[model samples]
Target: MDAQEKIAQILQRLETGTCTPQELQWLQDWYDNQPALPMHTFRDEAHKQQLKTGMLQHIHAQLEPPVHVPVVRMRYGWQIAAAVLAGVAGICGWWFLNNWQPRHKMILVQVGTGQQKELLLPDSSRVWLNAGATMEYPQEFSDVRTVKLDGEAFFDIKQDEHHPFEVHTGQINVQVLGTSFDVKAYATLDETQVTVKTGMVKVLHEQKGLDVLSANDQLTFSRSAQQYMKSKVSNQQISEWAGGMISLSQAGFAELALTLENQYGVRIRFNPAEMKQDEYTLRCSKQLTITEVLDLISSIHPVQYDIKDKDITIHRKN
Candidate 1:
């Protein structure tokens, strides 16, 4: 067989997890000797990266068993590199496929009200799904690492320089190679926000605009105004929710209510319309129960709350 054909066979064995160590070494040597191909060999730069990422991830998976790490403790750069390697691996496999078949199996992770969940992707990327959030991803990421998110999440992505990790929300798309960031894009909210804690993130709003953010940078896109605002925040602690802490600075009552509902699994109703204008700056620890939180809020604001089962009603104090 020709060299190209031989390399293809080796890659097939790798994919099936059947490649002998000798075969793997030969494949590696052959790859090292090959000339640098044009980027156009794949559909786009992103696709090219995805292929590289996939290959690297496959290699690692073969060489080492998966290591389970807390989502918050994962190494940011390594996660990104792993994602990029996956892309490269995918490209290598795709090039040899005579007839490609799509993988239809998908995985959906949903966090119920007042609950949070942690997920580990096949590529070793970690995701923390906040309360009342849902994430949809493929059982196995092939070329690219892409996920659809509704509500909020904090991602500690595995690094692969070639592939980009993309999180799609209703109002915006957050893309990164390897980064730690929080994305809040609930459908009910008028604004979608992305906060970067480490590395860099690219936030896209279709044809409207795009914003690239670095550590401690935040981007907010207003769906109603179709405008984006960028700011540097001193408190990167917003992501602390993943660790059972809630911090807010001059946040409006509506936001506070939503947060409480999500974190406590309660339905909160504010009466007479004026409560929406109420704002507060506060911090709550996980030790505080939902009732305690409401009590704390009522102590500061001119409001009283009545809790009945899972429902809460707040009214302006007379």
Candidate 2:
């Protein structure tokens, strides 16, 4: 690749938290070797200075924190060199870095209510995001394979034993070499859950190892109680949501309410009452409308529901 192409690749890897030590050193060296140019080389000083500042700001804004990739330091007098090169090199340097490099920046995907999306990560892993879920990843992944998650998603990670894959939910971290799993860690919920469908995974909290789990293993961490529960889950139970189905067993009102809110994008409110059912069993299609789901749910219990716009209310029936 040409210098511009190589630089773009390096920057992409940097943006994705995958830049290697050698590539980083090369970037530093490239900046260090820029020939100093006199101020008069540029057409206008004020205009050049303004453009330079804007370009740097834009580049920095597109980058993740320096903790992932060290910030490239510009040598003294490099500003004039940059301005002159950008003007004389037919938009080869700074201009190219700003415009052409954006293709490699961080990317965010969000699914709204009553919708779902499937995506392929740079590492060839597949992800299915449920409604009201959001995930952020890079346009390309290099040495590191990682993504940030919120809400719920099912991941089929590609294998790269040398570079383990990681999913970050604010409360916990899931790491795997190659695995298919489902993660539920919606910010509005009181617990985060991980259910493995294949291979193995390690779950951590606050940078400390919590537990290592294998296929058919489920780990639930309660945010409020700061406790962990380990259980066995069926493959159907783990992959049902991805198949547009909702299956619950012995689930309480809060769990059911959150599921409805996520799938339907509605705010749910319950009256003050005992909301737990000893025989709480629910199975339905996510294709059902909010009203239909409510109807089905109420038929199994003595409860009433009302829907107004995006808000839903559930109360015990007398």
Candidate 3:
């Protein structure tokens, strides 16, 4: 048989605990004669030993118990058997590097201005990201489903009571199990809001639990003041942005400007001194062009707007 075929047969025998002593010796000799694998560098000696022990232990657990081998030789036989398994696992050189390596790949998704995105996570959870938002998640979730968000997202998580889902933002961490919720935690905005539409959510700050919210419940945390307020919200307002609509109530100039920037993929520049502290309540369709929305605003309030190719300037009418 060819060298690879012979090696495969030997490994198969070894895995099944049917390798004779002579076959075991021959396999050991083959491994010794083969070229060494490209060694993975470790941070420290202790870390290296720790990983080695873990791999060997895992491989050993999968192997069938040795048969017809003397008790005195069991220890040495098992060690050699594990080494053979490791060597076989390194067949393509790539498998060993990827599987035996101690790193988990993380993926980052960024939504550009005026754009929205939808993702189905490994756990079958669905997320809808708003414009000007970014999210980070591991390629595969572990014991706990965790994701980081820098803007706003609506999450409909699948039920897994054993593995609670977590959303980490700037000011707060939200934990849930099979729930639908919306989180608004833009870095530009001073306040972080967590609103639940269904199921229960637990919000925490700095590892301390802030409040538990149920359906139609909202928790607002002010970053600047380091304060928390829990209030009731209408279910329709929970994730209205995801449905091609923008709604605001008692919103300030900055909030309005930010919403416009994210929705239109434009930059807005306005002088705070020239603008009044007028709170605007707007419910408009996201399909409206930047100029159209600005015109609508002007009709309601006496304000002049200048639009120049993805940039807008607003000032109070003199």
lDDT of each: 0.76, 0.76, 0.80
Worst 10 residues of 1 by lDDT: 69-78
Candidate that beats the other on lDDT, 1 or 2, i.e. the better one:
2
RMSD of 1: 16.5
Q: Model 3 scores what on Cα lDDT?
A: 0.80
Q: Per-prediction RMSD in angstroms?
A: 16.5, 9.3, 12.3
Best by lDDT: 3
Off by over 4 Å in 2: 1-104, 272-279
lDDT of 3 by residue, 1-318 (tens): 655556556556644645555565666677678666556545466755665565455445444345654433334666766665555444423333443232257889999988889999989999999999999998877667999999989999999999899999989999999999999889998888899999999999999999999999999999989999988888998888889988776667777889899988889999977774677778899999888899988898778998888889999888
Q: Could you arrange the candidates by TM-score from highest to lowest? A: 2, 3, 1
RMSD of 3: 12.3
| Residue 34 shift from truth in candidate 1, angstroms | 20
Off by over 4 Å in 1: 1-102
Per residue, candidate 2 scores C-alpha lDDT tens digits across 1-318 of 656678777656644646554564566567556666444443566656765565444434433346665664433324433443343332334435444545457899999877889999878899999888999987766455889999889999999998789999979999999999999888877789999999999999988988999999999998888889999978778878878888776666887888888787799998535565434568898878889988998898888888899988887787
Candidate 2: worst 10 consecutive residues by lDDT? 84-93
